[model samples]
Target: MDKGMFWAVLAALLVFSLIVATVGGVRDAIVGYVMQTSLQHAQRDMAAAAVRQRAEAARQRAQEAARQREALQARTLAPDQQCVSGTVVTVRSNDASQLIRGGAPVRCSGRLAEVPLR
Candidate 1:
């Protein structure tokens, strides 16, 4: 081939290779960006799911505690006759003086009336 034609062919081949490389690089960059965005969305979704699970657990615990309180209240309000014989232990000096004025070793007996649940 003549020197002029060979040089022209070489320059053309160089330009073609550069174009291909540039296109490949751009494609790689776009793919990387898309993958990064997908990962971020997945992490956010996982965090949201964790928060929802924690809230549900807390709600369940609160409901269980409320049920326990209600059961205790029901037991307290049950209709049962009983006699309680015990000394009223004073908490402080003033309370002791009041108990002394009323009298010591007080005995009480009563039946709790049944309460209707609303």
Candidate 2:
């Protein structure tokens, strides 16, 4: 082959190699960026899930505590008498200058009754 032709072919091959290398590098960079973004999104989603779980757990605990409080109040206020009687009257008036009040005092008089154990 002629020397000039050989030189031309070598230069063409060099340029082609450079182009291929550059395109491959750009492709690798794009893939890496996409993978990184996906990973970040996954991490964010996981953190949000954890936060939701913790909030749900806290809500459940508060509900349980409230239920326990109500139960205790009920047990304390339960009537333990053979005969129990009480009167409660609530009065609400929207009149500007009128007073309203009338109710009998709560009273319990009876022999102690047996309470069953839980």
Per-candidate local distance difference test: 0.61, 0.60
Please give, for residues 23-54, the per-residue lDDT of candidate 2 as tens digits.
Answer: 99999999999999999999999999999999
Give the per-residue lDDT digits (tens) of candidate 1, residues 1-118: 9999999999999999999999999999999999999999999999999999999999999999999777656434223223233322234434432122234443322322133122
For model 1 the TM-score comes to 0.64
Candidate 2, superposed: residue stretches over 4 Å from native? 78-118
Candidate 1: residue pairs that collide:
none
* lDDT leader: 1
Question: Which pairs clash inside model 2?
Answer: none
Q: Sum up the clashes in candidate 2.
A: 0
Worst 10 residues of 2 by lDDT: 109-118
